[model samples]
Target: MSTIIHASAAPKFPLPFSHAVRAGDLVYVAGQVGVDPQTLEPIGGIKEQTEQCIRNIEVILQEAGLTLDHIVKVTTHLARVEDQPEYNEVYAQMIKQPYPARITVFSGLGPYLIEMEVLAYAPSIRGE
Candidate 1:
């Protein structure tokens, strides 16, 4: 069976979509932009945005009783490919060693500089 997940602390999605969905042993998180939860406004530049995006994902994962350590894969969209170096610096600081498999590409993200989605492995954890 699958379950939809929501995080009260995460930014409200402008569109209709759950924060994440748990299916079997995996939790697939929706794409997260660098927006403040209360304001739902995109944050600063790529580095700051990257940090917020991961923080947003962390909140969603927390709702599922999971953490960044549980993530097995990641897909990111960057409005500018040139922002990669700064983005990678912040990512490395937050995601620890044995980093999740990741792929990043340049894409038009409207007003946002970065957006990220993650897949986590959680064979034992359950959502409330």
Candidate 2:
């Protein structure tokens, strides 16, 4: 069985997708954009947007009774490759080391400068 996770305190973007889903022992979070929860607008610049993206992911994780510490893998998407360094600056602050396995891709990501999706491990829920 699987469960959909939703965070009431997170930004309510009108989308047909759950914040995260739990299948067996893993929690798979949707791609999180840099939109502010209060304003629902993309934050400015790569650094700020990266921070907001991480914050959004954090909210989803919290709703699942998990945290960044539970994350085992991460995938980041950037609108511009040049901002990779700036993205790293904020990302490094949000996720601790030994960091989760990660991959970064540069692509056109609508109005948002960056986004991220994560996979987290839940050992206690393996049989659920």
Candidate 3:
């Protein structure tokens, strides 16, 4: 009745976790950081890190047979409050109109500027 989708292009941070898990019609993505998939190093500042984080989310969505448009909400984590403006600019670039509900909190990641976790929803063909 349900399945789990693992993102192949996801960054391997020496941890045991799937990118997203699909149960019923909802897909839950784990907290994603701005690290290169191959290099495994943290990306640039807030702006650049935000871009990379979104990209990683996109990859996970694709693997789960979804897209950014399917996401219902997003939770962002930042190391610095001053990065809010820059993070907004980068975030808006990837997501389109009728944006998903969002919440951004401040957390200090190891040697990182920002981290993000997204909650995405998929349509239920069975219910409707």
Go through the candidates in order and give each one's C-alpha lDDT.
0.91, 0.88, 0.83
Candidate 2 per-residue lDDT over residues 19-88, each given as its tens digit: 9999988999999999898889998888889898899999999998998888889999999989999999
Clashes of each: 0, 0, 0
List, residue by residue over 1-128, the lDDT tens digit for candidate 1: 99999999999866999999999989999999998888989888888888999999999999999988888899999999899999999999999677888999999999999999999999632231
Which stretches of model 3 miss by more than 4 angstroms?
124-128
In model 1, what is the error at residue 89, expressed in angstroms?
0.3
In terms of TM-score, how similar is model 3 to the real structure? 0.91
List runs of model 2 lying over 4 Å from the truth: 124-128
Output the worst ten-in-a-row residue range by lDDT, candidate 2: 119-128
Highest lDDT: which candidate?
A: 1
Per-residue lDDT of candidate 3, residues 45-125 (tens digit)? 887788888898889989988888887888988898899999999888888867788998888777888888877778832
Residue 49, candidate 3: alpha-carbon lDDT = 83
Instruction: Score every model by TM-score.
Output: 0.94, 0.93, 0.91
Best by TM-score: 1
The superposed Cα distance between candidate 3 and the true structure at residue 13, in angstroms, equals: 1.7
Cα TM-score of candidate 1: 0.94
